[model samples]
Target: MAQSGRTNSVSISHRSTLFVIPKWYNSATFPKDIMRDNISRREGLLMHNKMLFVRPDKPITSVKNNSIRYSGWTYVGSANLSESAWGRLVLDRATTKPKLNCRNWECGVVIPIRHNDEEKSSYIPSTRGITTSVAESGGGNTSAGSDDGSRVASVFEPTVPVPMKVPAQRYHGRDRPFFYMED
Candidate 1:
């Protein structure tokens, strides 16, 4: 879900929720103003009376170098949320694992979901440079149109990388780090 476009506005509805993984790409396609407008409109206004989740702290790095829209249990892999990629998942009745019938090569990481991990799932990074107020206030970009009307264009705001503090020991036992989300 690139922040500069209106594609996501279609997928949201009363019965469903949309969680947008954030991005830091500076291309014109993902402008900061549009991103702010989106956060304000979809998240701030509490669209659907509170369903959309847009947390810029959770930056998603994709193989295509873009942000992706994620929902619950369904994993769309590296593919877009299109029919071909999402329509083929079948549950293995015995093992309870999801099986996919793919039309092309794709990649995804599957992690077992635990319903009780609310603390970790809801921990929004407050120290990160960007905040909900920043996104809602149109932090540093010029927005040309109203939220009800089509956005003419948006300017990209360059972001400085925040350094991370090292812990005494690794949190995850594995060599690589992983992120987990719950609904």
Candidate 2:
């Protein structure tokens, strides 16, 4: 999780960026009070156009929910926004190049942004798949998580498609910062 004070540390709006959050995560594990507090702090910076925050029109968990459609790409997976899950930065002495050390067996489906008719796209499974003209293999477990050749898939995928929501609505508070929600 990003620190609230760290919210003032960078300027990504100059490049046009936004952060999207779910309307409600499972409160049994993540409480509502904590969500409100973090949103409150970040809202101040977002209000000035430093960046944007969005919530979905329907609870992302509901299939019948009114989903917002976006023109850009999307990432669907169980990974968090942390360095460890994304991959830790490592300096390679031999090549003198920075590399992302991916030690865990993590996988995801990345949908690329298609802006025009000339653009072509495909979704490939990271575990095993055919090599295509547009495919690029990234980091993965070197040993396949024990040489048994058979392993169970991780059961930790998020219940809701967390990244599919678009900016919709936010409650207007005169003295408080506003967060975005998808309608």
Candidate 3:
């Protein structure tokens, strides 16, 4: 599929709906023009089809009958639709998600990466930054809690030490402050 040497042609039939995915494509393997042509063949065309979910969105499962006419739900996952037919990689009865360009939270958030009107993302950032957690608050060098659940500080680290004791006032019946506000 190298651009230097590639033929833009493939056979298709009106029989079964083509479940297109990258089978064999790589930098050294598929050149620019060739990759473009191949992608144009399926991915590009499918992308233009509004009825189909483009990008990483994939079916979760397939329930096939005991016949050759059709099968079950053809579930898809994070394998990224490589140009290879790895139906075996499809994990049955497994907990998974259709690979997303962003995360679950970032899903549907729109982004303006291009000048054209067509180049708009379906998702938008809910906040000013991509700070997932306090640890990720500082440019990622500051990691979240450790595997053992130890704390990791961020730019907004506590200014005062926790469990600070307020000045105690003498009272008739209290030596320690009442833990509950109701009393």
Candidate 4:
């Protein structure tokens, strides 16, 4: 966990592996120098300028009065991590020719964690679980807890904190992404 003033950064390490997220470039909530150690040498930086949603585990009641266990999900937007979102070249086996296939609209996908036997076959198991901690501004003490006071472990391993709030707020009526206009 990285600590500076009232800001808290979560780092999950097990065995010899460490996952660290440096401070975002233009964040209003967490300023620069939020990380405890210098991370300029890190291989990758999360440069997406979009919304992130995080939801820890929770319980819900079903229509049949049964308790439903909610795990979590990971969403990848088209603009950020989809090869089809940009463009991909493929060889047409039937036609014996090469062609380019492109997705013309914005899209995203939400992958849910395995929660039952039916999902066991389809869902992949994650090797690492998520652990979070918030430290005091100056005390530098770290503990494990999230907004729900529970540790969120995904069926998909190696979870990292997104550069946004947990359980992101829904967009209001007027909220929309910017689009190009020819005017």
| Best candidate according to lDDT | 4
> Model 3: per-residue lDDT, tens digit, 92-112?
345564442332221121211
- The all-Cα superposition gives candidate 4 an RMSD in Å to the true structure of 15.5
Q: What is the C-alpha lDDT of each candidate?
A: 0.30, 0.30, 0.21, 0.33
Model 2 lDDT, full chain set: 0.30
- Positional deviation of 103 in candidate 3, in angstroms? 1.6
In candidate 1, what are the lDDT values of residues 22-79, reduced to their tens digit? 2322345753342332222333232222111123333334446344421112121365
Instruction: List the lowest-lDDT window of 10 residues for candidate 4.
Output: 130-139
Give the C-alpha miss distance for residue 181 in model 2, angstroms: 28
Model 3 is weakest, by summed lDDT over 10 consecutive residues, at 147-156
Least well predicted 10-residue stretch by lDDT in candidate 1? 160-169
User: 3-42 in candidate 2: lDDT tens per residue?
Assistant: 2223554552221122333453423553332122122223
Better of 3 and 4 by TM-score: 4
What is candidate 1's local distance difference test score? Answer: 0.30
The residue ranges of model 2 lying beyond 4 angstroms of the native Cα positions read 1-70, 113-183
Quote the RMSD, in angstroms, for model 1.
19.8
Each model's Cα RMSD: 19.8, 20.3, 29.8, 15.5
